[model samples]
Target chain A: MDILDLAFMQRALLAALLVGVTAPAIGTYLVQRRQALMGDGLGHVALTGVGLGFLLNESPVWMATAVCIAGAVVMELIRWYGRTRGDIALAMLFYGGMAGGVMLMNLSDSGSSANLSSYLFGSIATVSEEDLVAICILAAFVILTTVGLRRQLFAICQDEEFARVTGLPVRMLNLLVAVTAAVTVTVAMRVVGLLLVSALMVIPVAASQQIARSFKATFALAVGIGVTVTVSGTATSYYADVPSGATIVLFAIGLFVVLTALATPLAKRRAGRTAAAEECTLEAPGERTAADDVRV
Target chain B: MEQPVIALRGGVASLGGRPVLRGVDLAVRPGEVVALLGANGSGKSTAVRSIVGQVPLTGGELELFGTPQRRFRDWARVGYVPQRTTAAGGVPATVREVVSSGRLARTRFGMMRRADKEAVIRALELVGMADRLGDPVDALSGGQHQRVLIARALAGEPELLIMDEPMAGVDLASQEVLAEALRAQVARGATVLLVLHELGPLEPLIDRAVVLRDGCVVHDGPPPEAVGQHALPGHDHVHPHAGPAAEPIRTGLLT
Candidate 1:
């Protein structure tokens, strides 16, 4: 309660809430599209953007957003042209981004690495007013694009080839997803850092899929789970000494494990009941008599 | 004669430097049900894919509803059902929601009007899965899942329906259900092109069959009666001989 009164803590909490909602909202599509690792890939690319910002004395969040967007476009192009799996291109970008960021950070003045460390591990203590503003703007953009494209996104995620055959602009929609994901990773980097940002994107959705029966329900539930983890994890981190990013991601993983453990058996039981009901209906006298008559 | 609903001539496509469709020609007239039959890797899927612009033709001419393939933007006139795979990409979408997506081309800016909803419900009814509208697609049996996919295509009310292996992996009961659904569509004057490994329940509805061998059209004529039996699993060696061995049939007798 005391932490909520502090200005920095308030900003940190707000940032957590925003990222929490936007991350999983975007993650729902990525997870459904089987591109869960794309968040991690963009996060790594964001680090280089952060390093570029440090070297140029610009806003790191904006710089990171720009770099990540470019990285995302390049990654998509690779997927479009490359013969191998899209993950191969993502793996290349993932390592390349981290390595590029570290080298760029090393190339900067001696004191900059300490500043970059805040981004690497995430420090609620460092969320500035400008960073908060950036998160709000980018988060709004991500949310709007995702909501507006919900139908098309769902169609493509269900089956890309089928979506194409139906004449949806599959390629443009895919690029939109990539760019939105890039922005989400950049905005979330301040709350959960580059290393753990993807967990915020993927973990909640993974948990939601275990129980939610509809896409809308799964998306809403994932957002709820994400928000809960980010807010509670931020609060716990403030009271304890651990980094907020790691704490949030760890909390998410714990939630996923618990939800999966609980939902699997319940789902199996429901399936068993449905099967039994179907068998009973099939053996009803009217149907059995018709079958017997046909045989005779 | 009215122009064919779908026309692909000299279609040549290569994937990963390997030719998948080599000089393939296929044409389906309005209200006709033509099946594309082939062995695995014989390019049956690719031919259908090419018509819908999924596969780029290296050297070919394609037309849909009399418009050049390059200029064919009237998606509402066409419906496509891809082969059913085991995974629905892990997206937890209810049957109604999945079927509603087929109406995307008809909806402006992706906004579903009242008519779209009615069409979706009607499609579900046609597939005999109306009761399972709220259930997740993942919960359905393979047959039921296939039926839901067919309903998705039907919701569009497309004049030309192209399906790739709709019967593959489906049980007989579901196949019969799908056959009845297709029959209804054909009755309403819908033209159909299908890729099938064998003509089972769909055989009765098929007006003609085009068989592909190694990416080339080997036979295009009345549905091979012998293929109905040869198409059975474990009966791979029974090849149908329709004409002189020296010449490939370029046109179907039914046409």
Candidate 2:
């Protein structure tokens, strides 16, 4: 039977596709808000939850999801109250989470350490039927919430003070973003693993922003890039005997590098053209200067 | 007597445990262009922010259009232009998209109606940014960015327009365009409250000036004549000879 016909391979691919779509969908906002590392912070917290599960002999995925949501709320509160020094609080949480996870994992049995390692690097062959169902349900919730509040989220991200002045419930919308980010990170952990899930959430969005002109276009293109990278990376890892999470993240970084290299010259050329057109229309024919043609 | 469109009586507010506004009283009648003048840290921005409910008052009363601020729900009736900063943040939105977002309070389910789109276009035209509606805002100059923000506010068709330092970093040409735009809005009977440093081109349109010094109202009448004479050296020091009560007014001129 071909690899596609194998049940484990089929499940892994489905999970990859689902995460590939949702991670960057939520990530577009995170990247725009300059909070790209929020996903990584939540992912670290999820690892702590997984460690707790190992200690208690429970389903690690469910525990991780719950802990991540709670951690996200805490982070949001810190961001609100800490004001200018909010990044310090986030950094504390980021390091605390990783340290806590390692300590908790050490306290658990040695056999479970192997399981934790799989979650760290991700083993596509190990995604069970139950994990697939959980991911689908959570992914659906994330997508729905994000779609319902897209405009409000965009407004808050653009300018929080202005959004508040407009009576957009800026505080509530900010909390919603944090919760959605947490959910996305939790669901993505299955595919890219806790340590590398942030790559799936941020890289494609960064790549798309370089080329896309508007917010909507950037979001659409990021999703496209995300799905392509996840699907191809999964297949490559399967055939090449590589760690799936690392392979997928590396693939995304490579694509980002390529897009960045191509975007600069194209953007400069387009800007020059627009500048020339503007000068031609706004200035008198006799008064037009050659200096106006030079791109700032 | 007709009630003022914006009334902040005994307005006291604090930020991070530091008192910013102390028993400040301001009232703007309908159709009047009022300028809030003060130097940096004079609490002019904080006072307006309190009116918009962004800054919580430690002890005071703010009323918008005859309704208590706590009970006011008519957000579409108010337009706001915050002080300009580097517009680099979040997603790169097109000029049209940014302006369209201004109408959100008036739209249901965040869906823009045809009328909403028309208003956005009209607002852009008002600011002379109609030709660049599809351009990303980040690519625009500081002055162009300010105009886009003003257009965003105007798109909402607010009865009351509150702008904080709208001309702070704008170029002279853009300032003229903004002044003309304000003239049109005033002619249309929109109530405007502007926080300004020197008034500049907008000086002619201002009917009343409320100058603040260390969070207290020092002058509340015609625009200070000293401001128009800014070209003279030591203009700020040439204050009207008066008693101790006039000290705050002299300090306000230092702005």
Candidate 3:
């Protein structure tokens, strides 16, 4: 509670809270679509934007958002039109973005490798008011898109063909998902760092699914776990003098391990119930009780 | 004269530049139960998929309910069940949730209204899946999972229902249940189109059978006289077409 007195600590906590809510919100859809690593890819693409920001003496956060959105749209296009070995194309895009970022950062007047290192590892003390403002706006977009259109997203992720038959703008909805996921990546960049951003997005969802039996439960529980880890991780970093990004991601991984262990007993109990239900289904069709002979 | 509920004229589709449907023509009248049959890779699935707009036609034209496929926007009038796929592979979802997605066609912003909820439950009951509404789809057996998928399609309550490989991987009991459900839908005058490997329990309900070989319509007439498995003309490696063409009798590519 005493850490609340520090101005920088307050900013980091707010950023952490937003990151917690937005990451898994969009991440649930990505995981459902079996593209859990898309966030990591976007993070790499965003580095180019961050470097461009330094080169132009503009806000790196906004630059990263623009670059990430562009990369995500391109990725979606690749998924649509690329005929062979699409993953190799994605690998090229990711590495190209990373290399381009390093080159651009070196070309900038004020930017150095040390400055880029902060973006890679997430320095809480460096989160400016402008970055916080950008995070809040980006987080809002991620939350609204992920929650307001959950059913549409769920239908698309569950079965894309059926979704198209239902007259959903499947292509448009897919593009929206990519864009929203891009925004979420940038929102977490200031808190978790681009390198570790995907962990926060995927780990909490992974942890929640261990116990959650339904999409609704998985979504709510994952978001709950995300908030818990991010807030605590931020607080711990303040006291223990560790890197906030690593602390947060490690905390989430630990939670995943704990929840996985807890799910074992729950799964056994569920299996027992399922076995009892199957007993009824396994009854011989012609084997009848006295009711068969009795006239109604 | 009644307009056909579905019409595809000389439909041509190529998946990955390899032609799947080559000059295929198909039509389904109102309240008709049509079965599309073919051997492995016979383009039966592709033909049905093209009707539902999942597979785009590279040549020719498609129309749904008398409107061209390009302009058909009334999707609530149609229900579609794709080939068997795990309903919840990466993310856990319950039976009710999966069924409710079918009802979303009637929704405006994905909000589940009370009527929508009732329709989902009713669809589940149609497939005898109401008992497993709260259970996760991952817990269901293969046959039961197929029933859930059927229930999902039925939830839309469409006038036209399209199903691909609904009987694949299903047990005998579940097959009977599906046949009975299709019977009820036919009784209510709903149109149906399905892709089947064999007639099986559904033989009695099929009003017409359209057989395809190498993406061309080989047979379109009354239910074949064969009642037992492998008694159908297309079941063997080499079968006679009775002089439709003066060329040699074609053999199944797979055989």
Candidate 4:
């Protein structure tokens, strides 16, 4: 209750909640497309935007959004033309953006590694009044896209070719996915930090899929787990004095482990139930194959 | 002469700098079941995919339902079942979910109404996969996966159905079920174009067979007589009294 009194703490918790919801919401589609690490690429590129913001004396969040959207579109284009070598290209983009960010930060007016570290590792101080407003706006966009077009997104992600013939505006929808993913990356940058944001995007969905039978269930369960870990991680960081971003990411990984362990027993139980009710039997034809049924 | 449902003229396609479809011609009239047959690397799949706009045509004229492909926007009239690749994606999805996506053609803005849900179930029932609706797609056997894919195509109830290797890797029992389902689709005035390596049970249903060899149409007419291996497209009949190079390039044309 006392920690809630602090303005920065309030902003930080609110931002964490938004990150928890939006990360896995958009992440479900990315995972379905098997582009689970796309958020990682966007997050790395956003570092360049943050650095540019510092050099230009502007808001890093907005700049990161613009830059990430551009990077995501470029990545999508590379995917179209360079299918075999897209990974190598993405690797170049990632490292180049990261190195450029470091170089640009050194040239900025506040040329200090400490200033950049706050954004890289996620400090509570980064969620200023203005940053919170920007996060809210960006998160709103992410939520709307992910939820509003869930079926369309699911169709495209599940089977791009099938969706194309279904007349799904497949090309435009693909670009939209890239754009939405970029928005989500920047939305999470303040709370989860650029380095650790992908974990929140990927791990929660991974954990949920272990038990979820359908894409819809996987999505709902992943968002549930995301909200659980992020909120608790923020509270732990507040009382125990730790980095909020790392704490939240570690919390998600821990949940994934627990769910993975639980998946085995749950799977065994379901398998047993289905096995007991099995209708089709391996009865070889014309040889009284069922004779062994009673004998065995 | 009725306007063909699918009209491809001098269709040319390439993969990795190699011309897979070099000046190929194919057409399917309304309510006709046409099977494109060929051996591996014969460009049969490429030709079918090109008509569906899945493959890039290097040079060709493609018309779907009397409209040029570039301007054709009536996709609800077309259903495509792509050649299944073992590309189980990053997350699990139920069989029903996958089939429901096929009904996206009939929906507005991807919203599934009551009629759409019924259509999905009806499609599954047509393929005898209604029972597995709740099961995860990855948990199914290969033959069952094929049935689900066919069901997905059937869900849209398209005027023209394009399938690639719907029977590949499928069990004989599943094949019979698929054959029966295709029969029903034809009975209802649906046109079909499929790519198959062997005619098998589908031989009786095919109104015509267009065989491709080295990216060219080598045969086009009534379904070939499936007299053992003789009916197989690109089946090489080794002659007893011949030189060491006894296996000649014998497509369905020579048969």
Could you give the TM-score of chain B for each candidate, in order?
A: 0.87, 0.88, 0.88, 0.88
CAPRI-style docking class of model 1 based on DockQ = acceptable
lDDT per residue for candidate 1 within B68-90, as digits (tens), equals 99999898888888775313355
Q: What is the lDDT of residue A123 in candidate 4?
A: 80
Runs of candidate 1 with Cα error greater than 4 angstroms are A85-89, A275-296, B85-88, B227-255
lDDT of 4 by residue, B1-255 (tens): 999999999999999899999999899999999999887899999998888888889998999999999889999999888885324357888888999999988998889999999999999999899999998887887777888888888999999999998877665677888999999999999999999867877889999999999999999999766676565675544323334533422111111
Q: Model 4's A-chain: what TM-score?
A: 0.93
The 10-residue segment of model 4 chain A with minimum total lDDT is A287-296
Worst 10 residues of 2 chain B by lDDT: B246-255
> Model 3 chain B: which ten-residue window has the lowest total lDDT?
B246-255
TM-score of 3: 0.91
Q: Write the per-residue lDDT of candidate 4 for residues A1-296, one digit (tens) a residue.
A: 88889888899888989999999999999988888888888888989999988888899899889988999899989988898998899999888888888888889997488878877878864589999999999999999999999888988888888888888898889999999999998888888788888888999999999899988999999999999988889889989999899999999999999999999999999999988896766656655533222221
Residue A170 displacement (Å), model 4: 1.8
- What digit string (tens of lDDT, one per residue) describes model 1 on residues A52-79? 8877878889999999999999988987
DockQ of each: 0.36, 0.30, 0.37, 0.37
By lDDT, the better pick of 3 and 4 is 3
TM-score of each: 0.89, 0.89, 0.91, 0.92
Quote the lDDT for B162 in model 3. 95
Clashing pairs for model 2 are A32-B90
Q: Rank the candidates by lDDT, best first.
A: 3, 4, 1, 2
lDDT of 2 by residue, B1-255 (tens): 789999889999998899999999999999999999987899999998889888899897889999999999888899998874323355567888777878787788788889999999999999899999998887787778888889989988889999988886566677888999899999999999999877777989999999999999999999987645566764443323223522322101011
Query: Each candidate: how many clashes?
Result: 0, 1, 0, 0
